[model samples]
Target: MDVLSLIGIILAFVAILGGNYLEGGHVGALLNGPAALIVLGGTLAAAFVQAPMSVFKRALSIISWIFFPPKVDLIGGINRVIGWSMTARKEGLLGLEAVADSEPDPYARKGLQLLVDGAEPEAIRSILEVDLYTQEGRDISAAKVFESMGGYAPTIGIIGAVMGLIHVMGNLADPSMLGSGIAVAFVATIYGVAFANLLLLPIANKLKAVVLRQSRYREMVLEGILSIAEGENPRSIELKLQGFMG
Candidate 1:
């Protein structure tokens, strides 16, 4: 779990609520259900319209990465690559057949299979780069779904604010209701701005970071597999792969 992400969420709530309290405002003032509904519902509706079904589904699936990110072990990857290099050196390229079979990562496994089949280095690079970039593009598109939501949220909030003000305008004859009505109208704006900055945008950026790290890991794997295909020394392969760590 990402302890920092947990802390950030808790702190965001505390900061907003605590600041409201310190301003001589009560919690109930910010608990306008209509405002929340307008902001959240409208924002989601806008997001649904803008993102394709696949991208939207991908966004939903990866959102949990904010707290429980996919692991990317750079040191471990380098070590694994070195091991593959050694195996290939001693038993030849065909020796990687067993390693390919047992490899856990589908990306790495595909690269290993290519090596085991005695693919030319350029052929392996071409195949793996396509796989790498295709997956990266898909994931980046998913992250952009959340980013699109973030961009839409503030404007949707403004719309909510306008709708609320229209309601306030309709009730101008009731002077006693004016204060609360106006407050409710502005709450939508607060919800919109806060939701976008605190949650949606942050989620998108974090998911992007996770995707990029995964891509880098795959790139490292691809490089290792290519090196083995070209019959490079394990020590040289280790040094080359270590550059990815930095």
Candidate 2:
């Protein structure tokens, strides 16, 4: 679990609410249904229009990564690569067939299968690089979905504010309606800006970071598999793969 992300979320709310309290503003003042509906609904509608169904689904699927990221155990991965290297050296590439059959990660399994099939080093590199970059591109695109939402949210908020002001202008004769109109106007702006900065954009960036980390781990696996296919010494493979850690 990401304790920092959890803390950040709590802190963001506390800071905003605490600051509001200090300024003699009650929580109820910020709670405007129309403003929230306008900002959140319009922002989501814009995001839906911008992203394809596949990418939108991908974004939703990976959203949990902000709090529960996929594991990237570099040390353990390096050890597995070394073990594969030792196996290949002991009994040739064919020996990896059994290991490949039982490998859990699809990316690593594909590489192992290629090595076991006696694929050339260049072929292995080409195949795995395609897989690596393709996946990275997809995940990066998914992360950008949140980025697009962030971009739209603030503008939608402004629209809400303008709409509220228009309503205020229309009801100038009614003094009773003025307070609610103005509240919605300002609160809509706050909601839009706060959601973009504190949530959407941060989620986008964090997902991107997670995607890159996964790509790096896959890259390490690819390099290690290629080294084994080329008959590199286990020690040299270990040393080379360690470079990825930094």
Candidate 3:
């Protein structure tokens, strides 16, 4: 689980609640169910209209990534790649076949297979680079999905507020309920702004960060494959890949 994401959201809510309590404000004032339905439901409906069905589904998946990020053990992967390269050098390209067989990651396995099959260094780089670009594009699309939601939320909030105000105005003749009607009307705006700023945008940024980190690993894999193809020393390849991390 991503502790930072959890902590960030918790702290945001806690700070707001704490400030409200300190000001002697009753929590019940912020607990209007109708307001939440207006803001949240309206925003979701607007988002469905703004984004394609595929993009909407992708956004939902990316939101989960905030709590459970992709796990990539870079150091371990690098060590294994270096070890295989050394063995290939000492025992010939065929030696890498064994390493490839034992490897679990399809990316690394594919790289080793190319190396063992006598693929040119440039060809290996091109293949891996294309794959890297494809993966990056997918990640970017996922981030854009949330970004679209962020774009829609604020406008939806405005729509909700307008609807609430219209309803309030219709009931203006009821002097006893005028104050409560106005309060409920403003709650929709509050919900819209809060959800957009606190949840959607932050999740988009977090997904971008994860994509960048994964891109770094792909870069390392590219360098390792190219170095091994060129018959460079395995230690030299390790150092080259390490530079990317730092």
Candidate 3, residue 239: CA error in Å? 2.0
Candidate order by lDDT, highest to lowest?
A: 2, 1, 3
Clashing pairs in 3: none
- How many angstroms is residue 84 displaced in model 2 relative to the true structure, after the best TM-score fit? 0.5
lDDT by residue (tens digit), candidate 3, 1-246: 999999999998898778889999877887788778777777677777777787677767767778998887789778977997789789988899988888887777888899989999889988988888888887778787677677777777777677777877888888777766777667767777778888888988999988888888878877887788888898898888888767
Instruction: Please list the C-alpha lDDT of all candidates, in the order they appear.
Output: 0.90, 0.95, 0.81
* Cα error of candidate 2 at position 148, Å: 0.6
When sorted by TM-score, best at the front, the candidate numbers are 2, 1, 3
Q: Give the range of the ten consecutive residues with the poorest summed lDDT in model 2.
A: 112-121
Cα lDDT tens digits for candidate 1, 125-175: 999999999999999999998898898888888988888788789989998
* Superposed Cα deviation of residue 30, candidate 3 (Å): 1.5
TM-score, one value per model: 0.97, 0.98, 0.91
CA lDDT, candidate 2, residue 202: 95
Candidate 2 at 204: error in angstroms? 0.4
Q: How far does residue 32 in candidate 2 sit from its true spot (Å)? A: 0.4
- Candidate with the larger TM-score of 2 and 3: 2
